[model samples]
Target chain A: MTADDGFDETLFELALRMGDNALILGQRVSAWCGHAPVLEEDIAMANVGLDLIGQTKLWLGLAGEIEGKGRSADDLAFLRADRAFRNCLLVEQPNVDYAHTLMRQYLFDAWHLPMLTALKQSAEPRVAEIAEKSAKEAAYHLERSSDLVIRLGDGSVESHERMQAALNALWPFTGEFVAPDDVDKAAASRGLGPDLSAIAERYNETTAAVLRDATLSAPADAPVRKGGKEGLHSEHLGYLLSEMQWLQRSHPGAQW
Target chain B: MTAAGTLPSEKDIWRWLEDVPDPEIPVVSVVDLGIVRDVAVDKGGAVVTVTPTYSGCPATAVIAMEIETALRKKGLDPVRLETRLSPAWTTDWISDEGRSKLKEYGIAPPVQGTSCAGAMKQANATVACPRCGSENTEEISRFGSTPCKASWRCRDCLEPFDHFKSF
Candidate 1:
């Protein structure tokens, strides 16, 4: 039998989800390349995007190897349909402004830092390896984003308002990241994936502390909104894919 | 350097690696920068395992080539190379001599005693000037000429320099 013939699909699905989060978030953050408020901010955001894309490449490469597919990382990244993407809706959302980008990054980085740290002990050596590396990068990412959240939130009235608004708008989607599901459950049972819920408390504690220091409060509460894990995404993802994949789709197998 | 039909020992292999300088920062060797992960000596040849400083750092390909060429020139044939992504390369891996060399080269080394994740909560440490040894430096940008560095300027020295990022 082939690698996928008799194996449980949860591992592949989990890996896809992990990669999609990084890839889509990378694209979103990269959108600010030329538009950032200052040169230093521009360079910083680009560095963050580069790190995310690098992590994506590693996760997808492992996914392809485990599936025994002839497909390489590029094929998986450029050839997939928008519906097939498993990234969170939060990552695919448009970058409305610098505050929005920072808030989104702050939320995700908090979750990513701890999740990757715990995943370093995964049963799958490849997964553990990827996590070990990503945890380091994610740490730096968290540091930058968290620092910005505090700076902007406490800087001026307008800046604080913008950051607060972004937090309110994005709060609902943060829930899905730590929400338990069957795939995550199976991975947790096999010791291949860390329980995201257990890590959620840590993520929450960290985010709350930053928010307090920033002089801005998180949204009081919101319903747990989710969908991207099941190949479902916001309308924004379709447009993003069209823009990202246009060149590749227009000319099949084109090389730089 | 080796003579014809004679195998190089582990000592010779490591010495050759130490002589191979980093492609981007030629001031330091790969071993001093801590990218050379493993050097395994076999009967016929040696296998070297390296970890790239960053995944997409352009210098990595050049690094692999430099390692091979350095070994090949020493009469070592078929020196196999492998890249490891796990336990990602950290600035903490830089040797004490490497740190001193970086300072002499006008680049501030990473702050000691900080890991990637914990770096977030730790308040900014004093970044001393490599040229004047002053603790008055302000980071200009989080990224610099290379993936592993940040751009900073010293208030006292009035000179811009690259600070090797902690991660």
Candidate 2:
């Protein structure tokens, strides 16, 4: 839903991208609530999910305001179809295994931390405010995820192989993080958001260092897979939406 | 014991708020945790400003309701609660008394001097054990039971404890 009709469509799209990314990933992480490999890890995953969900409120709340459609964060999150979501494909990838889940989180956190750090200096005050608060949490998330990546990637043969395979499978989806389209270009030109290319450069350096430390090798010049930003998602997103929106869709206005 | 028709002074309101315990950490008051940023009372009503310690802290709403209820019990009608995001809450804001209370309650207080901006960089910062008073503590996990805490264990006593995170 591009904000045509004279509204700041760039801001709306950028906010939606940020909000949707967090919402989808948060939902995925929250799925591990009672099913983690260990008790401590279960608690940790849930905490991360909670933090991301909390951030979704801030980002989507701003999106709704810019859209001027009287939509709240809940309405945007629970009611939107897969085609309406603006999150990158990386986050929407299924958590195939614990290693895959950790890799996905590490990859997203690597981009997310730098993205939020730059947004702290956003031209929009509301965006900057949310970024300031969110950056701290993102930093913590990155620290934990990167640490796990290093540990598991360098662990025993089985664990190392698992981590390596997960990295290879998820690597292609990361291209969308830095791949700029018209919306990203407009947002950067207007100074409403950070330049995706600059953030991409930082993302490469960060992920490279972490992968090196983890003893994991990524495919060089891997084919870039994109399109989630423009809402063309994988089959996985539809399943994710069905489960996440079931309660709200089945019985509208349901609340605890 | 304020006189009828006379609003309690801000100092008095602050004092009464000290008795309102945090829902999660009942041993410490919200004021002790630095959640209540400001309080003002006028003839119209009372307004209390609060900042959530974590973006996803579930206790935020409950803390607001508790504050309003505590104020209402004091005969302060038409109380208003405001949420402020700037000057994001930090463990540094936690009062000295809060730190001591947390320690006594078996949760290690955050190490002083760690800036919230550089929180992620201070991953290896030393945290003393509240159980055995040992400085040899190892972090079990960065994410703890609550958003503001981390799980740490003392080498000497070998007892697991929660450390109030620096951010």
Return the top candidate by TM-score.
Answer: 2
Residue A243's lDDT within candidate 1 is 89
Ten residues in sequence with the least summed lDDT for candidate 1 chain A: A1-10
Q: Which stretches of candidate 2 lie over 4 Å from their true place?
A: A1-6, B1-3, B117-124
For model 1, the stretches where C-alpha displacement exceeds 4 angstroms are A1-4, B1-3, B119-124
Model 2 lDDT per residue over A55-79, tens place? 9998999999998989999999999
Per-residue error (Å), model 1, residue B98: 2.0
Model 1 over residues B1-167: C-alpha lDDT tens digits?
37766678887888888898988888999999998888988656778999978765678878899999988888777889998876778888899988888888888888876745555237567788888888888878778777688888999879898988777
Quality class of the docking in candidate 1, CAPRI style: medium
The DockQ values of the predictions, listed in order, are 0.58, 0.65
lDDT of 1: 0.85
